[model samples]
Target: MSTNVLPLSKPVPADSSLRLVPDVPDFVVGPGLSPEVADVVTLIGGSATAGRNLAETRRIFTQVRRALGPTVPDIASIREEVINTPAGKLNLRLYRPSFGFRPLPALLFFHGGGWTVGDLDSHDTLCRQLAIATGHVIVAVDYRLAPENPWPAPIEDGWEALRWLSNYAPLLAIDPLAIGVAGDSAGGNIAAVLALKARDEGGPALKGQVLIYPCTDLSASLPSHFAHADGYLLTRKQYLAYVANYLAGQDVEQDWRVSPLRAARFDGLPPTVIITAGFDPLLDEGRAYAGRLAAAGVPVIHRSYADMVHGFITMGGRLPAANRAIADIGRALASHDIYAFSDGGGI
Candidate 1:
């Protein structure tokens, strides 16, 4: 990592006094946020009901489905399938775009639940939106979560699935050249690891890697982790709880399987796009990772929604910025320059 740190240049937005509903997590428009994005902040923040943290997080995810229903696309086709990873068979939900994929692009996405709670169902809408917004076929991976599979299992599952998907791109009517990987939070960790692995191992080449507020480092030292540690939608305590459960007493925090930023090198990883939120704990790490890619001379686009919180990508359809972010993601995925590094024998 470089010695330079990019300090926040502007004054922070969203003082504690923003107007919101008088009860349980009301909506509030704050600094660096527009009205539409505020609606998403209010919706997600107020969705927290009293319960075990995991159950409460699930409730918030459920509330996300109820609140953001308008943005979800009508599924033209859902092909539920599985892949044979070294650990075992893993599930993948394939979303064929509206125009079809007899010869289209493919995005292999992974869901985020801090490596513990999410599944195909929790992220179905997000995948559908990507499919509809980008006009590409999407394969949502159901890699085993931590506490159940742990460490290398999720990483291995993601890698194997992407490999097979790339190899069978023709069968799925996808252009192998246009294939990419995506994920949020823990899933982002997996996607990033897969990118590093594929590049280093000489497996299938990828067009891009999309990381949404990813947890790039496991040391818990980033400023976002401390700044938004509590009551900013996802508490640092809750995060540690999730990680503890995810790790299950394993001291694998520094392992590349758990922390992709620790990878020995980044020169050959895919062109990258990383998304972050202003008030989320994992925000700094996402930004830092983008910088790492840039320092390695990889093409990268880093976006920060300063008024938004963690898990904002899934909330895109309801919020205009989120929608715009999704569109931006699609464009990045479909761009022609992702492979520019390999042109003219420069790589």
Candidate 2:
């Protein structure tokens, strides 16, 4: 580990309010962040979504995610399928584990790119790894992206995919009863919403939900939004831009469907595994969401990677913790005995 402390510079876009370390005079690098990630941060500099319009931002994001993503591991089998929804054709990729039993438990994964950029290919490697680690089938949903198919469109696609998967579980040898939802970032937001929706609809009961550094609150007023906003890969400017693009000029920040943290109740939701990054902007809200779920009597397991940042889960190639986190998430998804664990706070 490098004992070297990098100096902080003013954030790009001339935003004086954005602080790398809130209320702290001296800004040091790798406070708790691993040296591997810190070196990558220095190499990458700032957000790829910075200073670009929607089209360019999307292109850059796609490129960066692919280039920095972990090495793809070979899985048992991968097949593509399409579900015809009222909105349109929703594409999905199913990954079967090499060693899981017949009718294996499955996880429906949503890719993260703020809801604007990512697609099936962006998260292909991660899903493959998840399937292998958990010994469960992994269904990767290639939902519609934003600024094109904005709010509720991705959700609609996600919900329809779940329904379709449940209805046709036998076709793919999936255990309908053992189905769960998992996603990172914006996809995490969708997974959280879908868990609630499934509970309310009273069918297709989910086994669990894995939320990886999810942006639970669109309000974006949490303290972490400013505390670790600038130096990390995900900048505040980019975060708001993603939200705006998803909203598509609509004022729906308070909508529970858009922000699951705003939901009136969290009870009866599936057992949840919430992964939070200490240096990510969404840290506070992710913790708050876990607390809310626990308070409502839902079984929740909250894991905080105190040295990581937002979107670190996708950069497993550059950071060893990301790969370890993926395996940890796999155990959470695979375990049926997860309710035995506490939410750490005993809330």
Candidate 3:
């Protein structure tokens, strides 16, 4: 990995799609968020590359969660239970908006913790914001973390969750047709793979898929790995280290679930939205996936946040530009009629 950090001010298109959040206003983020979360985030961000292997990585991440405390969002309803699946029991948290729910679009969310850490608690605010902004039923999937469960475990949980969601629609009060999958970083990898799996297997098709600064490739050869390898929040050394543990001698570089960019066929996938952070280490791969989706004739809309770093979407409620993304997703959902689509009907 290169020691140089790509300056956020580097040349890019002059459109509003490019964003940098720390430069934006402070209102997007609200009060009530504990300061302890900030300190914990810094610790994990710094700990990114310190883990010698998966075991050590899991130990450090467990410590990080202890430091971060728990979810503090008012609207976020944290359900800490295990859902029985064909593969095994998986953990999940379902976040419902303040609005009364008859039936609404459901977004199965995967929290980003490098596939090592992160749970429903860590992503409380983001899920609340998504529920409010998109007016949808957001079910955040708390799949077993890596090194503990590894690649196929997380991937299998994700796919089963989707099937379970479809199979148990009445229990969830979700419009089966209006269902979609979303996540950031490692979660995004799951979302991309889920979208592909549904299309290939003739499973319940998603209305739309949202990927926020997704890590689409695991080979560690993308340019952003070197271009923004240091001092930009997400370091390349930290990235490779996390994957090394999460993968742990598993062959994931070619697995479509681990690296959605490697999927051979992309046609017939749902209309999609791809969000990219300009200074993010995964920028190139995210954009490339969007391009591939477009090339494959999938209706796709791509946005590049020029000034933001990786994980800005999770911070949208705090930064002005991030708030815009929240609203953008809402409007897109409105068009998709996320609440109205049903598998038996049209999604």
Q: How many residue pairs clash in each candidate?
A: 1, 0, 11
> In candidate 2, where is summed lDDT lowest over 10 consecutive residues?
1-10
Ten contiguous residues minimizing lDDT sum, candidate 3: 1-10
Give lDDT: candidate 2, residue 253.
88
lDDT of each: 0.72, 0.78, 0.69
Among all candidates shown, the one with the greatest lDDT: 2
lDDT tens digits, residues 89-169, model 2? 888888876643357777899999889888777677778878888777889899998878899898999999999988988
Candidate 2 vs candidate 3: which has greater TM-score? 2
The parts of candidate 3 lying over 4 Å away from their true place are 1-47, 52-73, 76-81, 98-101, 316-318, 335-347
Best by TM-score: 2
> How big is the positional error of residue 87 in model 2, measured in Å on the Cα after superposition?
1.1
Candidate 1's residue-wise lDDT over 117-235, tens digit each?
77777777777778887766788898886666677677878888988998887776677777788888888888898888888889788878889889888877888899777656666
Q: Candidate 1: list runs displaced more than 4 Å.
A: 1-66, 98-102, 334-336, 339-347
lDDT of 3 by residue, 10-82 (tens): 1222243323222222112212223422322232345445535556545544434333322324553444446
